[model samples]
Structures are given as C-alpha cells and as structure tokens.
Target: MKPGLELGNTAAITAKVTPDMYAQFEGQIVHRAYSTVSMVYHMEWAARQIILPYLEADEEGIGGGVTAKHVSPTAGGDTITATATVTGLKGRAVITAVEVHNGKQLVGTGEVTQYVLPRSEIEKKLASEQAK
Candidate 1:
C-alpha cells in the first residue's frame, strides 16, 4: 500500500436520487429528502471503487467505520456527486476522506476507514464459523 496520500485527492462518482431511494417518516407531509444515512451509502460506495483497484482479487477489504456531517439537504430530482480519496494507510487499514456535492453545492463530508485482508483467509474464517 502507498503512503502519504492526502485529503481531497478525489475520485468522482455521481448518482441521481430516485423515488426508490427516499425515506418516509410518520407525520411528515412528504418523505424526507434522501436521508444522510442514504447519502453516506453512496459515499461509501464511491470510496470502495476508489480503493478496490488497489486491492488484490483474493484480498478482503472491509469498511470499518465512517464519520460524516450532513451539511446540506437534497431532494428528489437532484443529482449527487461523491468524491473519495485515500488519505492514509495505518497497518492493515486504509483511511479515506470523502465529500458529496449536489449540483453546485457541497452537501456532506466524511472520513471512512477500511481494513484489508486476504480474501481467501477471510472466507475460510467465515466458513469455519458457519460450520460450528
């Protein structure tokens, strides 16, 4: 793994918010704008694409944690773009900084940590657990 990767070195990813992605809340006149939870989902997906190429096919990569602040609101009919970059690698974990922009506005920012391991080993471990 490479070191010294900085924040804001980004990979661009975009998605259109559709009805299927909205959240419904009781007593709310309309379904809330795509929730921050949903936005974060896209953010992580973008981050994965950015780092997946760096991982070997038989390697295991796990998204361990995320910290995000939802700064702006986006409703349906909007297109959101997420950018993620490798910021640091500590031991087996890779840290990423991510930002999401809706059209011309910055909507959210966050950091995510992922763990890398050999995929074959991870699968073997899972199978062992299942067998027990």
Candidate 2:
C-alpha cells in the first residue's frame, strides 16, 4: 500500500463488445450477447487502474478475489464501461467496489480484492514452487 490510496479513489475503463466477447457453445451463439466473463475482465482492468499509479517499482498488486453480477445483456458493438472505487484497506489487502454500464444503464456490479506485495516476494514464491 502506498500514500494517496484512500476510500473513494476511483478509476474507469471502457471497452467495446466484440464477437470474441460473446458467449459460444460448439462455435455457435449460446446467447448472442457479450459474455458475463468478459465483463469480469473489464472490471478487473478498472480495479487495476486504481492502484497502478501508487505502486512502487518493487511493489505490485495481485488479484485476490472477485464477485460480480450481470444484470443485463449487451450485444456486440455496444460500448461498455467499468469503474472501480476503493472501499477499504486492511493491512496489505485493498478492496474495491466495481460497476459496469452500457451508456447509462447499469449492467453489472462487483467487488474486487487485491493483495499488495513486493515483486521479490512473488518471485521467491514462484521459485519455491520450482524448487519443490
């Protein structure tokens, strides 16, 4: 965690729906609409923006968890916007509230949690797994 990180800090990102973002089953349309999973990616991107400017060279934020609800369907070519607001911080944990919209209509909402840690610590953790 770094200074200037506070509750109410927010970031927003926009993405347009594409054919690849739609749901498919057996190469056919499952619903012919943007997939809920794709919205999750946008939500995470917005969450990442909230902390990127505050991170040190040796520090990084690792995603911990996300929970989202899709309330509406979006067709391909529709522009979607996702926003994240910092809601809380507990030690190394940073929590954010996320929302998605198509224009002004609310399409999704979520909570995203990320753990702030040292890059060296993560590298060491990966190395430990290789050592085993």
Candidate 3:
C-alpha cells in the first residue's frame, strides 16, 4: 500500500472479443460467446492495473480472490469495456469492484481482492519449498 491509495480510484480496459475468448475447446462448441473464465481474467486485469501504480518498487500485486458472474453473451467482434474501482483496503490487500460492459449492456460484475507482496518474499518462499 502507498499514500494516496484510496477508494474511487478506477481503471478501465477495452478489448474486442475474439474466437479465443469464446467457450470453444477441443474443437467442440459449448457456446458461441465470451466465456466466464475470460470475464474473470479481464476483470482481474483491470483491477490489477488500478492497484499497480500504488505499489512500492519491491511490491507486486497477486490475485487473492474473485467472485464473478457472466450475465450475458458477447459476440465475437464486439468490444467490451472492463472497469475496476477500489472499494476498500484490508492491510496490504486491495478490494475492488469490477464490471464489464458491451456498449450499453452489462455483461458481468464481480468483486476482486488483490494482495500486495514483496517480490523478494515470494521468491524466498519458492526457494524454501524447493529445498524441501
């Protein structure tokens, strides 16, 4: 966390839907629209961007938790705008409210929590695990 990190800080990103974002796998068509997994990833991307600039040089944001819903289908070639707003802070964690829209339609919404950790601490933990 850093000074000036507060509620209402927002970040938004836009991306055009593509074949890869659709719910097709193994050449099987489960659906012909944006997937819930894609919505979660895009939502996290927007939330992370909002929290990054406030982190210290030694700190990195990691995904903590996310609860999301896919409410509507987004066709390929349609552009979606994902937005995140900081709503709360718990110690070193940031709580963000996220939403996705395709033009005037609401496609998805969620709450995401991101934890800021020292990069060195993560590497140290990995090294300790590897040593076992």
Q: How many residue-pair clashes does candidate 3 contain? A: 0
Per-model C-alpha lDDT, please?
Answer: 0.79, 0.92, 0.90
**lDDT per residue, candidate 3, 1-132, as tens digits?**
678889899999999988889887787768778888889999999999898788899988888899998898899889999999999988888999999999969999999999889999878977999999
List model 1 lDDT by residue over 23-132, tens digit each. 65553435647678778898888888766666766676877899999898888889999888888877887788899998879999998888888887778878999999
- The per-residue C-alpha lDDT of model 1 at residue 125 equals 79
- Clashing pairs counted in every model: 0, 0, 0
As for candidate 1, its clashing pairs are none
Model 3: how far residue 55 lies from native, Å? 1.7
Q: Which ten residues in a row are the worst by lDDT in model 1?
A: 1-10
Sorted by TM-score (best first), the order is 2, 3, 1
Residue 81's lDDT in candidate 2: 93
For each candidate in turn, the TM-score is 0.81, 0.92, 0.91
* Candidate that scores best on TM-score: 2
TM-score of 1: 0.81
Off by over 4 Å in 3: 129-132
Model 2 per-residue lDDT tens digits across residues 18-91: 98889876678787688988999999999999999989989998989999999999888999999999999998
Q: Any idea what lDDT model 3 has?
A: 0.90
